[model samples]
Target: MRTLSPFHYIVFSPVLFLDKKQNSYYKKINNSVGNDAGSFAPLSFYNNQPAALPVPWDTMLQKGRDSVLARATNNSMGINNEYYNAHIKGKNGRIKAVDFEHNTELKDFRMLMKLIRAYEVDAYFVMQPLNPHYYTNLKDLNPVIDEVRKEIKGGRGERAYDCADFFVTDTARYDKALLTDVMHFSEYGWHLVNRAVMNHYALK
Candidate 1:
């Protein structure tokens, strides 16, 4: 991984390493977000020129959040359809067969953890909730997760929280209301994640 700035905590999802194409696509998205930060800001015109004013940070953030939520809801069906096609009905549906065992993305993720450790940041890898249709053998993915946890722990002996297994323990019984798309969690789903994290860390 790339050089990382110091942070108190770093939370990420393993879904980021699912595939090369998707990984590259997300990197581009991250770059685009960085480039578009000005657009996300509440801007105003000063003498026919665009300028960022002293907008309330919370208000600007809420505006951006609302915009994204609106877009996501508006495109939910299409997004879910695409996920189904790619992960369930298409040739790539067999995710277990995908070369994630030794993927470059995994290497990058490990490097990221090492960098985080160098900064003494608390690193947490949240396992994303998979759609019930695509939910498969968790045991198969444990090796990768375990490696990540072990590397990050490195003598500190902290463990990565098993949120994925917690949510999917019942197998084939995911709550549809918790999902906007096949893979993307809805607000309620995020609430559950928040509670789980809080509980795990014994946060107030």
Candidate 2:
């Protein structure tokens, strides 16, 4: 087992990992998109631009309360079938029925687990909070996470935390007050996740 330290701990969400081939595809689409506006490839909804300042409290609250924002965010991350289709296989507003043998992300994830074990690195795989109404199912992601746990020396328990389920335990957690878009979290939401991690590790 590895001890937790600044360099030893690697916390990440599996949903965001893209393989090398995917990167190449993104670049190709990006280049082609400029030449043709009606290109079939999914356009990137993620904004790489830096924020001018911290998000206001009112804006944070609006994330969950505003139907337009909620629909747009959910559609962009979920139903739009842009980026998700390339990496995952699912349909009808869902993206979590992962096929272990075919998923490149899971393959890379397993490789990452092997590296972590070889290097004795402590890591945590998180499933971030989702909108209750969102079609993506976090629980469907358990198979890969569970598979990787057996590879790590002591990977279960503190190593993974499904914040999506945590939010369900407390209604306050999923409320609009902690929302900052559907996929991202507000400051309070992050604080809750941090506290959960600390508690999982028995850290005071």
Best by TM-score: 1
Clashes of each: 0, 0
RMSD of each: 14.6, 16.3
Alpha carbon lDDT of each predicted model = 0.45, 0.44
**Model 1 per-residue lDDT tens digits across residues 1-204:** 122211111225422222334445556776776765433332221123545454344464455445434544323232244444544453212224124554555677667765655544433446555444344353454555555456645555644334333234234455544555545666555665665554554444
Q: Residue 6 CA error for candidate 2 (Å)?
A: 26
**lDDT string, candidate 2, 1-32, tens digits:** 12211111122543222334454577677777
Best model per lDDT: 1
Q: Give me the displacement of residue 47 in model 2, in angstroms.
A: 38
Clashing pairs in 1: none
Cα TM-score of candidate 2: 0.39
TM-score of each: 0.43, 0.39
